[model samples]
Target: MSRKDRDHFNLLCDIGELAALVTGSHNIETFMDSAVRLVSRHLKADVCSIYLYDESAEELILRATIGLNPKAVGRIRMKPGEGLVGATFENLHPIRESAAGGNPLFKYFEEADEERFESFLAVPIQRGVQRIGVLVVQHETADYFSERDVMALKASASQLAGAVENARLLMDLYEATGTHPEVQAPASLQFIRGQSASEGIAQGPITFFKKSHVAFLSGDAHRNENFTVEDFHEAVRQTSRQLADLQSRLAERLPESASLIFTAHFMILKDPKFIDRIVHQIAEGVSPPEAVKNVARHYINVFASSSHAYIREKVSDMEDLAGRILKNLFRRGAEKQENEKGKIVVAAELYPSEILKMASEEVQGVILVKGGITSHVSILARSLKIPLVIADHPHLMHLPEETPVLLDANVGNIYIRPDQEILLQFAGQEAAGKIAAASPSTVCRITQTGDGTRVRLLANINLLSELSTAKELNAEGIGLYRTEFPFIIRPTFPSEEEQYLVYKHLFDEMADREVTIRTLDIAGDKALVYANATSGKNPDLGLRSIRFSLRNRPLFEQQLRAILRAGAEARHLRIMFPMISSLDEFRDARSVVDACVRDLKREDLPHHPGPSIGMMVEVPSVVEIMPALAREADFFSIGTNDFIQYTLAVDRTNEKVADYYRAYHPAVLRGLARVVRAAKTAGREIAVCGEMGHETAYIPFLLGIGIRILSVGPQFLPALRERIAGLTLAEAERHARLLLAEDTLAGALKVLETPTSG
Candidate 1:
């Protein structure tokens, strides 16, 4: 082979070796040390070192080194732009010098004894836009490093970056939670890391949380196949009853959102395909546990292999239900444990119903070996304000029950076998104080801009419980009442009476205030299994919202009838259709409402004469035809969430391109401006009922654009009210005009960032 070929071959080998070493290395120290040694040897350098960035301190601290004083490893630190290392990290580029010692930027540490090194190469270790640290190599001979060496080192540095980050995060958790390095198991076998589901810090003794444990039987223990089938059906019935009872208990103690968890569970138990699979297995003479395990494993594998995060989370739900059925088959009632206050529950996984059952004022937090943020359990945990971390650490399953541990969900970390100092530090960090203080009642008064621009602040509610919170927050009315909750929380379509009761209760609570009831917005990412809605390849652009409602007219009419019946008792009720891509869809939906009203009148049913009709302007197609839609529709709501997504053609949920889904994009701003202008020209009421409404930075821009109604989460009411009370109409209009003139997202953001005139 040629000399160049040989060098290239060696470089490839070195990269492979480095990857292996970094992957095999157990902890931060070992990983860093292995990296420096491997890089120095490959590049023929005398010294190699790594400096990790400390975000809180805004400094780079020396973590690992070769040919330097060992004592200086943790002692040396440099501020950004202070030395060669800092400059490389801050600039996010590589620095190479043949005469390193004489450079003014080179700061020599006396402890390192590195004055002899004349050539220096430093490169930043980065993960995307985030700069993690700097990697450096020095040679005793001047001009020793070459372009080939730089490329090789950069490749090696990239491999080490993620490992280094994981180590740093683990160390930070140890320090914060007081977990001693010595007590931790081998780095390769101990740490379980997962995404943060909820935010908060919690410390308490660990309790292995499980509803039941069953032993597997070989060949069904030779039990009769007919009996096994009967046993399976009986277990299914019992599991159904258990779920219903749990759902009732949860409904009494938690919000309807929490109780909805069992709804999914109930559906799984009644799923004919799932039950048939189990029955088929039982017919083959296997025990119920084996049948459940077999069927669950198949579904779990299918779901886990799905590319969508939402589908993958279903594995947890399926496994939870399978376990419930298995437990019932074993005739194992709910396992009871002694009352333990402030215990952190640890389990392989937790379902929403399980979380609700365990939720108590005394319960401290939760740790799961496997779960995703989209899981119903995670949603419940967030709603209940419980600290939860999902760590798939290998040691988790082996930890002794009741082992003292610290869980910090804020950063998705758990410290096993914590020390006294860690406990003391945790005690000093008051978790309760982190919660936002309730806005004072004085802020509950009517909100207007400084220049007397009356802006209606309303609440976007999905559950009846939120109505009370909305009232407490002094929301003027319900701007966006998502009506899909009742449908989503049932095994089958909710009856008109069931729907009527829910709507009646909401109307009774809001009393005279205007309540805008949005028809079922399902399909796409929010597909409901009970509704038999199957999400297509391009769900965002497929059957969703009004399209789904129109196709399933019976379901749609049922909801319309319930809404109309409830409107009879309501002083002011508005019915809105979601995802109206064109004028025809809106007119069609309005016609359905008209037909429902006529049907009610023919039956001598007392109903409201008529309700204001509106449609959500979310699709770009609708944006283009808003003038026509505004003329026909009674009002318009800008669903900014989907509007921006559809306009930009970006799926906000995909983390890969999430940064590109900018709400402040110039196109998005122009779109909003065009819609608002059209609504105003047509003399129609327009409101924004999306995440943008609650974002404080967007408030001034929104107000400036002539948007008079803003609907946000109930919790955001106080802060939004306070924000509106500080803005003036004139200044907002000026800011809006300035924002519209901008041609880029950055420029638009700058306009919003600037203080608006009060």
Candidate 2:
């Protein structure tokens, strides 16, 4: 390697070593202090600082520092485009300035005492697409930082990203666990809201995630007789063989899981502190088992202490590796650990794969202290049928472990140490829930009100795993099949053939049932990592859903072709366009579907020729032109989720506006009534296909508006059927009339909250 390459390699190794030590600090305060000093010394810089991004405040707060005013650490904050450091974070790129104050964006923080430094360099610490923080280094001499310095620093920042994330997660956990002494638990019944990631109701004892690495505890490392270095090498080889076997086994079950997951474990084995340290100790007359245990325990502490819940999860990996080696030393089999199973898992945050592992272990539900609502983990939780909610209230962490908890993920309410009244209420509802869950095969698929009015019930499916549940619930058909999930979770846009295989499986499963395939609805909250170039300040109002499809016509055409070929022999197929704000957008989308059919015919491909093309009435503008749209569109589906958001001019996912994003808003109810009326007059079939369909509180209102069709998540189909069975069309109409008569939200809510006389 060249001298520069050699230097870069050495710097990265030093960073990894430093991070390992920082991980064992066990708290963010000590982790930060140790981290900045180590980084400054390793890079041979005058100053090293870390600025962690506070997402809620949208500012980068100086978390730790060396060679600057220490008091300014938490006080100095910068927005994404405010200063030099902010520019690097916003652009996800490196910024190096020879004269720091010369840059126009340079805003001096008097408390930081950075004016003395003429050489400044900064880089964004990013893991994949998520920006964790920014790393900055400065020197006292003009033009002191070389291009090599910039490259080396950037590489170091990238290497430290994982460690930084872990420390941050640990910090979040600590704050939640009552690190602040003054914050006390409420004496009375308390309730708080968070973003609901998955929809379900679960009541279980809360189990805080800890001690996952205790499976093979090394009780006080001690010496043994006749243990040598040769035995240690043999144990290493045996562990590799075991990992190989495990890789093969998992590849059969989940091919994607086979990718690079074991790379970290293998790296640990080759790490100098791992095999080398044990071998050195063994050579110094320590027993082979003793040396291995000591080394493994060290790493376990390093991983479990200050590590993020995601990284902390790997403490088990370290223990498992060491356990495999120790088992080889004693010739024993692996042990199983299911401590968190059958309980609600409480953690700061977890990776997507960890969520899968929890599901495999039969975890009843999951509560996150902090995480995004539309993240991959959230999406996976929904697919796996795990109830998930993210409650950011720190008081949650201090609650007594193993206390009976009631989790209502449908609305993001958590009751800790639930009392008698709450328990009784949950029990009555659970009894009804049990009836809905048991003997699904015997439950009739047809839904009818007390007045004998038929309301067609369909499933909204995303994952193939949901197909069986949909079938068991006896869904008449699929109302909205979100195709974006396959695209969002993947590395790139799936080709026509790849999409063909997926859609083909769905068609084969639901052969004779109606399947409405919605085209790629992405670029908003559900963004593709590969397409981060489309990131915007306001994602909801930006180019998303149908706009994204029309902009990328070739890709859209590719997806349409796949859907057509997949459903060639299907009895019923419908193509729906989402986020259709105007009539022109619908026409443009329908034309592409037509073109795909023409090309398939010309190429002699087996493709469905005439699937009903429909548009989602999600955008508020669609309501004003619903009459015009109804004349041309084959069917209409009122997506109440986005409809309420747009009608009230509120962001659906914004926690601050969550109260305003309500289904019972007076304007929202009137809009729904208008759309249903338009569809009825046009003689077009319409369905309430959003959460409103499954929400029993809003079901009567939806039915009252003359919606005879309802579709929701498959898991909800059974409960929804049970709810509709108790309501009559006449009662719903009366309820709707009473609700429409109210002008204010409070008045409308009162009318909707009135208990129905079954």
TM-score of each: 0.60, 0.59
Instruction: Write the residue-wise lDDT of candidate 1 on 667-755 in tens digits.
Output: 99999999999999999999999879988888888998889999877878877877888877877788889989999777887887898
Task: List candidate 1 stretches off by more than 4 Å.
Answer: 1-245, 253-322, 325-441
lDDT of the candidates, in the order given: 0.72, 0.74
Q: Once superposed on the true structure, which residue ranges of model 2 sit more than 4 Å away at CA?
A: 1-344, 349-354, 360-362, 370-380, 395-442, 523-525, 755-757
lDDT of 1 at 470: 85
RMSD to the true structure for each prediction, in A, is 28.3, 16.0
- Residue range with the least summed lDDT across 10 consecutive positions in model 1: 211-220
Best by lDDT: 2
> What lDDT tens digits, residue by residue, belong to model 2 across residues 1-758?
36565455336544225425442453456667777887788678899999988765788889899989999988999899889989999997788999999999998999998889999999888654457789999999888877667656765675566556655543333233312244445655357677688978888887765422332354432233465577678767666655544444433433222222344455465444456678888888777887887877776676677423444555766775676676566542223333456788887767565665465456889888876564557767898778999988777766666767788898898877778999899789879978965734567768899878999999888677788879877999889888876665333344454466568878998998999988887755576644444657887788788887788776688789989988988999999999899999899999999999998787555789899999888888887899999989999898887888788897765566666677888888998999999999999999988878888898888888899989888878877888888999989999999999999989998998899855
Best by TM-score: 1
Error of 1 at 452 (Å): 2.8
